[model samples]
Target: MNDADKKRLLREMIFYRRFEDRTFEAYMERKIGGFLHLYSGQEAVATGVLEKAVVGQGNKNDYVITGYRDHVHALKTGAPAKEVMAELYGKETGSSRGRGGSMHIFDPTQNFMGGYALVGQPFPLAAGLAMGCKHKKTNQIAICFLGDGANNQGTFHETMNMAKIWNLPVLFVCENNGYAIGTHIDRSTAVRDQYKRVAAYDMEASQHDGMDIDIVMEAAEKAIDFVRSGKGPYFLEFMTYRFRGHSMSDAKSYRTREEELEWEKRDPINIYSKRLIDAGLITQDDIKAMEREIDENMENEIIKFAEESPEPRVEDLTKYVLDDNPDPRWIGPLQK
Candidate 1:
């Protein structure tokens, strides 16, 4: 990518990082609710690929599907910050009708299928989407992002095999953050390099440094081109780290303070921001202004979503529970 593009991505990543950091504070103050998964240290993978420079609207189409660690992806995909925050706050104005909560943010307009909470659940769904694209004679492909621990699930293997045999246009990204909800990668798997495991299915696989935005963008561009050229599936293993705990309640006993600090030194947002400054593409004052703009916009969104929306009425609890058919009208009269 060019210098301007790089600076744009650096800004986006920083915005996402700061937004999530504020989200944690909001969660504590009861402004935001539910399980909030901070994409903290793994910002580059999402920002680098999703930036308008690397991936754009074209005949070489693309789609992104991933696990529940999804706020960054949602933001990068063009979902409005206010809409996402409102969704988390369970407001009617949320992207998911204030119904899906934290794990099910879906915006078809942005092509982000809902985030899946079940381990490895979205992989097969992603593969099927790619298969449909091939059948429809379309060039579009789907990108599936998952964690290292998700590789252990049987669904992961099944999806890989099907994707390869069918020659489905899909890119499987494994964010190898070293730990899965507390367990490290070495202890969790026999083959530590998870990308190599794709060899069993004869799929193309490679690795990239998830922290370096440029490297991640390069790898994404290459894989995206290869898939668009009718090459079957490709797997990219990004070695990254999450600065926050797995969830709001994590004790973080699996790693040390030194380890956390060491990773912090390689923080994607800071590293990329510094790179932009060093390259003379952006200034500290510009960054300050950007941060101020994002903070003010997000704060107003939170307040609006909260004050203007109502909690899901108790009688409407079963309104969206069905799959085949859903009843729009309330099942019974309002209790209150």
Candidate 2:
């Protein structure tokens, strides 16, 4: 990457961090309800990984599916920030038409399939997407983002075996943030180093530092290249840490303050920005200006868009439920 590209990525990561930070505030103020997972410290994983996938195969349209910490993934896939924020507010103009919030940010135009709320749900679905791309000979691939805790789900193993047998064009990227909703990987899962978990299925896998965007980009390029070659599936485990609790509701009581601060030292946004600054590509004032711009955009535009957007109507409660079929059985009869 050129000096300019590095600087651009640094700002983008900062924007993502601030975006999530703003969402945290919104959730606290009761604007965003339901399961709110912030992708604060793990910005590099999605930003770096998808950076290659977007341009891969001549931008032939790759598919993305991840677990509920998906705001960044959706944004990186070209979903507008306003639409995402509106979804969090459950507004009429939100993505998924205000039906699926936070955990289910779906933008099919960009081929970001959706974020699944179920543990390991995206696993098999990702393989299915890859299978379709292979069958259609579109040269497209499916990128599945998963959490470390999700590796224990049965779907992980099943999909890994199936992807290898069929040689599906899918790349599974695991964000090992050391915990499964307060349960550390060591307590509940075997093989703390998540990359090795795929070895049982004889799939290609590796681990890296998710705190560094450039490192993730380099690793992702190699992995995407191998998968796009139709050699089957590749699993990448990025050792990362989440600055916030698993969800908004989580107090993070399971971990100590010392451990949290230790991981905070390796914050991805700080690491990347520091590198750019040290390289003489950017200055602290430039970073502050970028932050100011982001703050203004979020406050004046993104948040305003969501707050001003109308909520989904009660009469149309069942509207997007099932192809506009209006199934009273599902939502239990709309208002009389």
Across residues 65-164, which tens digit of lDDT does each residue of candidate 2 receive? 9999999998888888899999999998887878999999998877888998997899999999999999999889999998998899999999999999
Of candidate 2, the 10-residue stretch with the lowest lDDT total is 52-61
Off by over 4 Å in 1: 52-61, 323-336
Q: Pick by lDDT: which candidate is best?
A: 2
Q: Tens-digit lDDT track for model 1 on 1-336?
A: 677767677668777888788778879988777788889999998877665222334324367778888877777776667777778888777878788877788776767777888968988999987888789877778888889989999999999999999899988888999998899878889988889999999999999899988889889888888886898999989989999999898889989999999999998888888888898889999889988886776667654665467766777777776653535465535566
Every model: Cα RMSD to truth = 4.7, 4.3
Clash totals in order: 0, 0
> Could you say which candidate leads in TM-score?
2
Candidate 2: misplaced stretches above 4 Å?
55-59, 325-336
- Could you tell me the lDDT of residue 264 within candidate 2? 92
TM-score of model number 1? 0.90
Each candidate structure's TM-score, on Cα atoms with residue i matched to residue i, is 0.90, 0.94
Candidate 2 has which clashing residue pairs, if any?
none
